[model samples]
Target: MVAIRIEFDDDEQYERLKKLKKHRGLTWKGLLLEGEKRVLEQTPE
Candidate 1:
């Protein structure tokens, strides 16, 4: 298992992510894992 640390240096970026988190009804971990899945799906192996 791997752990990731997310640091937002921009206020807008952090707020946007928080808003999306609420809109999608996800906790911090869920938000990150879901985002990871999205990127993985778009990436070519």
Candidate 2:
């Protein structure tokens, strides 16, 4: 129910993420959500 915009510092940063997305065979949403899951799991509330 919300829209989020992601900004990369440079092309290299974006390219690095693109590579991970390709290697994981994940859509952009899946990749971002996976990262969010990891952060939540590692951090205490």
**Residue 27, candidate 1: how far off, in angstroms?**
0.7
The superposed Cα distance between candidate 1 and the true structure at residue 10, in angstroms, equals 1.9
lDDT of 2: 0.97
Q: Please count the clashing residue pairs in each candidate, in the order shown.
A: 0, 0
Across 5-41, the per-residue lDDT of candidate 2 in tens digits comes to: 9999999999999999999999899999999999999
Residue 41 displacement (Å), model 2: 0.8
Off by over 4 Å in 1: 1-5
- Each prediction's TM-score versus the true structure: 0.76, 0.83
What local distance difference test score does each model get? 0.94, 0.97
Best by lDDT: 2
Model 2 residue 21 CA deviation in Å: 0.4
lDDT for residue 7 in candidate 2, whole number 0-100:
96
lDDT of 1: 0.94
For candidate 2, the C-alpha RMSD (Å) to the true structure equals 1.4
